[model samples]
Target: MSTKYQLFIEECQELLAELESALLELEIEPGNIDGVHRVFRSLHTIKGSAAMLGLEDVRELTNDLESLFDRVRSREIACNPKLVTLSFRYKDMLTEYLQDPEKGLPQDKTTQILMDLEQVLDAPVHAASRPVESACEDCGSCRPENDKDADILLRLYHLRYHPANKSFDSLDPMDFLSQMQQLGPCEIHASPELVPPLDSLEPSRCVTSWDVILQTGADEETIRDVFLFLDDPGDVSQFREINVDEAAKLRQAQAAQLSGLLAATNRPVAPLPADEDDDLELPEPTESSSAPSSSQPGSPAAVSSIRAPSSPAPPQAASQEASEAEPRKAPPAGGVKAEEIASIRVSATKLDDMVDLVGQLVIVQARLKQIESELHNPLLTSVSEEIERLSGDLRERTLSLRMLPIGSTFNRFRRLVRDLSSELNKEIELKTNGAETELDKTVIEKLSDPLVHILRNSIDHGVESAEIRRAQGKPAKGTITLSAMQSAGQVRIVIKDDGGGIDPDKIFAKAVERGLARADSRPPDRDVLQLIFAPGFSTAEKVTAVSGRGVGMDVVKRSLESLKGTVEIDSRPGQGTTINIGLPLTLAIIEGLLVTLGEEYYVIPLSDVLECVEIQRGDDEPERIAKAYDVRGELLPCLVLRNWYHMGSTGPEIEQVVVVQAGNRRVGLVVDSIVGQLQTVIKGLGRVFNGMRGLSGATIMGNGALALILDVASLVTELEQREVAGTGRNKRSDRSH
Candidate 1:
């Protein structure tokens, strides 16, 4: 695709995100004018840009939707539930078409949807006979003499015109005046009061000027167009529109008989006219009244006097009164005040390029740090320290630029719940919290599908039917809560539902029936729950369109592990189910405990390591050949890395065990020796090692050494599987494998 088209797609995606947020807000408040206006503005902007790019289909569809929202804003029609639902449908269809324009649309379906929209527009409005007026009475004046001969009055002050030297060659003042005359007759007068002498005046400069009287039937817009071409050359210093109605009312109020008659009827009279030469005088009315009567012109009344007395007041008046009553207070000290947000259009490719550059910078910084550590001069050491501090700050700021709130990712589920609930004929309420928690942009993008699958599973199978819930003494509507929080150095996201929880017995039976486990196998509750993460294991009685496809949770687990994260489940048979996901704050850099097994080096994430213990030959042994350690009365299994990876040779008699904890499980990884701590830059294990079961990823150390980062959770599971198979005790099997 062309760069312009790519940029258009990115801009459209941002608009869709904004539209989704506004729609969700509308769903909650329904009468939020700001939210409605926001959605309307986004749609209008997208439609205009799409048209400019020759995306006719997108432009047309969005234009139609924008018009619908415009009517809602004008209060010509109320927003009903049905209209809101249709708006969501329209948003979805537009999003899909924009993402894949080549997917041909069905003409019949498109026609039906448009026809349905027209029916909404045809619905009766409350005040269909009245036409809305756009002119502001406060800024302009109007005169209505018997309502048939109406004239507008205007004022002008210091109106100067400048003509470009080139423009004067092709155009004359007479031609411009002729255009103005078409609107109204112009009576010109010249003032040579400030004119310089002929010799001082350059022929290139405009010396001629005019004062004119204009009388026309055209509106203000047409009158302004006459001077449009003159804007660049010079300025029209001042212009004003006058109201003839107010002038006539002032004349009538000055007549003594009118004032006396109005006073007797308890009606306020209009203001008397001031002398034309008295520019500083204010209009003085006969009485103080808030509004002017239609019979009187030139009344000193509110600017809104032109509005019908029965009509609703302008919404701005209420806002103005509110502001007057309680001025906006200042924010508290040390707080980040809210500022107006501006939306900018950017191409996705640009963002991708930026991320790639940042990644390369991280690698370069790592290399620099290695070089700095080896420098010996004191002056050089100080300079290196300063550089390191600055580089660290830069890296942090750049990474933060790519972090976005999870709220945007969470909002999509609102529509998902709405649609799925209607289809299943069930009542479900989705509650969310900690939506403001931010994560890596890439992680957030990849989280959407997995979250959708998890939510769908909760709604379709985790929650019981409304009738069943009520019978069980629970609320008729099922509730699902999605929440997130940052603890330690990781983000924890929990998806919990107040419905039927997972049954261990059923999972166990399924595992045995599918030959995933032996019938005689007996495991703890936690172990059985972990089975859900195994490939092809599911407890659904039958497959459905929504879920039960048996390809969801396992994939979710794998994806999380690939990011150096872990997923766990906790459930009580009659209570509820909660899925807990713990993810690292960043994937680029990490503090690790570096160690060596024979000749190879590896890193264990500092966050996971509890401590390191030295294991003697016969000090503590729990089983034959397999190493185990007792730390604070807890027995932890230790994996011998030299045997696991088949290292060539061993040198040290003493072995080191790195104790690591993930969730509630603790395991010790035995290595040849501990090599202290180092800051490492994470690198991916390429396709060649993509299927490696126990390694999460690889990284580069300071001394130009390649270190493998172990997947702790996966290694622990592998150990358990081997132990269950009764082959874990065989030393020969471990060495060959």
Candidate 2:
């Protein structure tokens, strides 16, 4: 794909994520104005960008969604469950159209959504049952007249024109008037009643009005069309049709007076002056001007007598003469204002690539620091320290570029909960908090599916049925809450439900039935509940395919683990369940505790490492150091690296025990020597090692060496399993005794 197209895709994905999160929030607090505004803004932005790229279908669909939001924001419609559900469908449709504009708009689903939206919007307004009428009192016409077979005619009328100061530019009044002339003959009479003196004219301010006489055989529709494009609908006033006989009489009198005046002038005949009065006044044609011979020389006396003694030249005529003698003013300094021009669209992919390159540079800088430490040269160390500081700053800024508020992803779930709850015949309220917590763009993208699955599970299984909830003295509606916060070095996202909690016994029985555990297995309540995340583990008596197949939670767990994250489950038999997922702030660079086993080096994530201690190894050493201490009384089981990985050398005389914690368990990993702390650049293991155990992945070290990054959680789990199996065998032996 072209860079721009790629960027569009990335931006669209981000917007979609944001839209989902906002929707979820709206599900809980349907009247949340901020949530509604956020979703509206995303849709508006997407629509604008798509229109810029000529993606008409995407633009049109988003425009409709935006209009729906406008109604909600205006309080014209209450946010009902139906509206929220429709919004989710709208989001999905917009996403589909963004992906493939040629697919030609959303299918019938979009129409249905829009119909539902209209119904919601029209509900209150329709209940009032009031007839809609034109705001103008004199104009009885409800709609504009057609232009076909229209004749341009001119009749005198008192008119008032007020250009909306906020809408139309001062220099552009003539353009609008010119458009008006297209509909009919427009005779403009300048009314100087409101005109201030030239010194205080305020050229930018409108200082005059036009008493216009427009004659058109076209109906009122054509006349209104002339002003339809104007920003202020109420400005064009005193509009009505006049009789043709009256118009003809006025024209005849004007012609006769002009002829008499021309006869009186010794010089060439000047143009007839326009009236300055706000009201229309047409002089009566009398017996004195019955003949057309007033143009002759002998009629000078008659012409002079007909002219009013004290009347001065009309303002229009003087203004025209003055305009010929003066030049127009220049525009203000600084080229055209920025707001007058349109905005440009850029792809977000280019920005992402820039961030990635910056991350790599940070790693390289870390390596240089290592080299500087070994060199011990004063000058080199000084330069390295400066570079290190710069790199650190750059890394922070680069990572920030990829950080987006969790709110973006939270908006989308509103629609999901709205729709899913209705489909399942349940009432679910979704609440969200800490949506402003920022996380990596990639993390946000991967989080959507898992969040959706969790939410679906909560609605379908965790939340009690509406009937059951009501019978149990609970509110008819159930609530699902999604919250996020930054803790330690990771972003913690929790999805909690106030519904019927998971049954530990059911989970334990299901695990044994699936052969995932022994029939007689007795584990802690938490451990038994965690079994719901195991593959194909389900307690639902029947599956309807929405969420009950029991394959979703496990997938959610695995997907989170792939992002170097962990999921924790908390539940009570009669209360509710909360699933907390902890994800690293950024996946690019991480602090690691470097250690060695034989000739190979491995980096353990520092976040998980509790502490490190030196263990003296000798023939007299205990067979197991389950009681190893690290300044605390806590006993941590130690795993010898050389023995675990089968390194080809004798054990170290003094092995270092790296105490690492994953979830609630802490274990000590024994290594030959400590390699000191190093900045590790994570690299994915190839497809061959995709399913590898114990190792999370690989990272490049400062010395250009490949170091395995230990998956602390996996390793700790494996060790615990081995220990448990050994204890079980020992118990069997005791039974024999």
Candidate 3:
């Protein structure tokens, strides 16, 4: 119902995930004190939060778990496999409790686990068997057994209500007072002697502190039940029983103190304005120091009040005020709350909007600089240069705001690895490195699905069985290592596994069966390995829910391509497999090289461009060209950009070529000119241009011109496809068949 409650629910779910992970780890290492403490803290926090929300069953369930961990902490009991299993069951119970708080706690499974827990808890304790009379004598406070209920006390209760958040938007203090009135005779008072002038008052703020004396037959517990949702136990609020006579005297003292406090601070005013109502009253100083003249001083007509439940004794804070009116005591140890962490929760949409706005500013800055250089005025140029520097700095800082460590994404896989390995009957270990490396939040969110596919493939297909690994002179447990590092302006993630690797023959056969590979073709080993990424192709003997779907590896390739990234895999028949993926740091903006092909502009990401060099080609016709170029002494494969785009034009005698590397291959891109580098804001080419390849996105330049951004990774893949198409199965048919 309240935003704070909603926030609590969201956070609770996240904490539960971490809690489950910790318990599973603890199950493996029973002596881990840190793990036990982590579980205890999570459960304790959940219990207190549930108590404040008045979710009784959820609170009780968490309390039980916290108590179990407390025993583990005290060395009274060790963490066992059975207890960890029960803890997981309890975790699920908490989830169902959140969904259906009204339904009674499900008793069937909980009862058995609880009973087993009791037996386990009692196993180590050897209490002496003693007679009933002796047991009674050991505890004098314990009364003799009686069926009749103990007499209810008429003692007074002192209650102080403090809300978790003091803002009026979160809670109402008067509504709490009304609930107290429903219990018994209650009189509440507030201290408002220094009320700011009416015009200066903030209507949304809460300034009044409550002091109340509730005269009721209800014991302290019943009285406390009224403020259950208002405060956590022993905090922000205090409820304790006091002597009835003392409560009466205290209320009288509070009234006297309030009157005295008001008379001391009140000052008489002259008159009211014409628009002011004549009946509106203001406090006037009274002659007597102990009592007020007619009306209570701070009791304004607009304040929320309850009718006196009985002989009106001023509320608890009044009594406290009376005591304070005498002397102040030293503060208690926990009188102040710990300072809140310095962070803000912002939605992803907000960050995207900020980047978009910053991108616009950058484009305008470039436009201004272009105009200034054309005019060649000293003063105008100076201003433009300053604007350019500031905009660049602002762009960097804005993009950094979207950068988050990749560790959170990596940590989520730990649980997946633990669960899936158990289900598949495999002994596997996952190790991660460079988790602290940072990337754009949007890019990281898109990475989860692809990483899952890659990791699952490594587990289900690449990893060999324990028996097979041991027989092959490998360790019984297979290891999957996921490491990431920053390279140039990209983040490179490599997932390597120590398991049985891909077999080229099987991959080629599977591709041929799926009509992807020619029946008689005999490609190189490396080329055959690439067939795993082809759509509708798998080497599985049978289909299952997880792997034989045949669509996973293709999905990984497509998702990575959408982010302007590249994925390459290497495998040996028995040495295991490794997959390397490279992605741009951020998709919001990139430093790009602007080039022209047939008067149409294009942007190639500057990160991928190694250098620009002039190329010498003898022929002008596209059909007469060779696919390789000699740069200095090294020969590199070339992609003729002008011919590829069907511009129907020839390049000059000496053309500029941008040498870019994709994976292990280098390709020369021929363009008319290299137009330096600047930051480009990437905009998507919508569904109408979806079929286009090698072009990832579009951007606007300073001269009101549009440039299509080139995707080097996909371009190289396209080149590979063309090469394969040209050398058809017919060329190699004799070698295989």
Candidate 4:
């Protein structure tokens, strides 16, 4: 696809998201005129853009929806649930068309929706029933039917637009003119005199200025809104209603008089290229214009009215006239200047590439430090320290560029909740908070499916039926809250539901039935609940279309692990369930505690490290050291790396215990010696090492050796499971006695 078309698709996706969200909100609060306007504006923009891209079918479908909402905005029709549903269907169909225009619109469905929209529009308005406070305060036309209404008189408007140079990237200026033409009888004049010669002309730029005289019943704001997307529309465009007396003289004015008047108010333009003749012939202006006509000069709708020829006035004289006429054109009353574009769309691939480059720089900086330490040269040490400081700053800023507010991702679940709740014959509302919490772009992209699956599971499994909830003294409408906040260097996202929580006894029974646990096992409720994430594990008796195949939670587990994140669950049988997921801020580089184990080095993520302390280990029976260790008072589980990995070498007399928190548990990781802390650039293992247990990924050491990054959470879990199994066997032996 062309770049422009790709951008158009991206823009449509964003607008569609906004449209769906607004429609959902409107369904909840029908009296919200702000929501009505949001829906209308999104549709209007999509329709205009579709028209610019020559997608007539898309334009037609979107225009119908836009008009429907416009009526809602004007208080001519009430906003209802049925209208929101219809708008959602339109939004979906528009998305499909934009993705593959060749397939065209589904005729039967499109016709049905249009017919429904017509029925809604034709319905009688109940002005007395509407909430008067909900009426749009600033909208002049947004009045109830019983209000004292004045007849809208046709007024002539003179508009001269010199579109901002940057506007052509997204909006076509000609489309604005066509929209005005749709308003009423309009005469369009194009000034080609400003166009530079062939060598200097930009094919994509809108250089030619336009002067239009339109007669319509539309208000001044309506006319001015055509150029609303332009930053500082008043700076480049002029729109004023002509006086009744001047309207008569304007029609009778000669070409010379009209040309002089335009020259006095128009901004100066780039002169023609040097090689071009000064007497180039100019195209004649059209006397009448209409929408959907040929864009070229002399087309059927391009009739002449007022023409500005190639021969121009002296710059000095034109400047004086422009200055004198500028004061007469006052800013519109109560007009707020449009803010400039604040952000631009960037390609994900480019951002990923930039991150990779930054990661490589971090590795090289580490190598420099290694050299400086060995040589101990004053000059080299100074240079290395400076490079280290600069690289650290650069790494932080570069990584932050990929951080995006998770709110957009959170908003997506609203539609899912609405649809699924209806499908399940329940009333469930999805609430979100701390959506402004940010995460790396890559993390967010991969995080989407896991979150969706969790939400679906929450709706299908966690939430009880509305009848059941009411019987239990809970509200009939269940609520699922998705909230996120940054903690330490990790973002903690909690998805909580106010529905029937999981029963640990049921989960334990299912685990035993599936041979995932011993029948004699009696673990803690938290441990049993964690079994729900095991592959092919399910507590459901029968499979349903939504879930019960026991696939989603496992996938959520695997995906989170791939991002070096952890997940935990908490629940009360009679209360509700809350799933907490913790993910690092960035996956590229992290601060790690480097240590050695029998000649091998490993990096443990510092975010999880609570503290490091010395522990005594014996040369013989080193494996016995993999037991509980006392930290101040509480005993924490400890895992000796040399024994866990089954290395040939034995442990030293003294060992370092790195206490790290994984999920809700803190464990001690024993190593031969501590290498201090350093920034470790994470590198993924190849497919050969994929799914390897205990190690999440590999990183490069300052001395150019590869150190496996320990998956502390997984390691801690494995140790706990081993200890539990050993206890189970001992209990069975006691029963035999």
**Number of the predicted model whose lDDT against the real structure is largest:** 4
Off by over 4 Å in 4: 129-176, 179-187, 192-208, 212-323, 326-339, 727-737
Model 3 residue 465 CA deviation (Å) reads 1.9
Q: Tens digit of lDDT per residue, candidate 2, span 1-737?
A: 44445556677787787887787778778867789877877776676556544566666767877887776765566667677767777767767765765566756876777677667666663222222444542231222345211212223221345553333342356644654554345555455456556687676777665545554333443344444334444566445333323233323333334444455554444444443232233233334333332132221111111221123344355444434322233212211234653654434587677766876876788688779878898998999889888877877787787788989788778777877888999988888899899998888988898889889888888898889998988898999999999876778899999898888888888888889888765777877777888888888888886866889998898888888788889988668898988888877777889888888889998888877888777564333422344436766676665655644467777878898877667788888888788766677788888767777778776667789988877677666765655531111111110
Cα lDDT of model 4 by residue, 169-224, tens digit: 66467666787776676666565556677799887877777766676666554555
lDDT of 2: 0.66
lDDT of 3 by residue, 562-675 (tens): 888988888998999999999999999999999987678999999898889997765634442226778899987777776666555677777889999887778888888887
> Which residue runs of candidate 1 sit more than 4 Å off their true CA positions?
1-4, 54-56, 100-106, 124-375, 619-626, 648-653, 722-727, 730-737
lDDT per residue for candidate 1 within 273-298, as digits (tens), equals: 33323222112222322333223333
Better of 2 and 4 by TM-score: 4
> What lDDT would each prediction earn against the true structure?
0.64, 0.66, 0.71, 0.75
- List all candidate RMSDs to the true structure: 13.6, 15.4, 13.1, 9.9
**Location of the lowest summed lDDT over 10 successive residues in candidate 2:** 728-737
The 10-residue segment of model 4 with minimum total lDDT is: 728-737
lDDT for model 4, please. Answer: 0.75
Q: Show the lowest summed lDDT stretch of 10 residues, model 1.
A: 302-311
Clashing pairs in 3: 211-315, 211-316, 211-317, 212-315, 212-316
TM-score of each: 0.69, 0.65, 0.72, 0.80
Tell me how candidate 3 scores on lDDT: 0.71
In Å, residue 638's CA in model 1 sits off its true spot by 2.4
lDDT (Cα, 0-100) at 371 in candidate 3: 88
By TM-score, the candidates rank as 4, 3, 1, 2
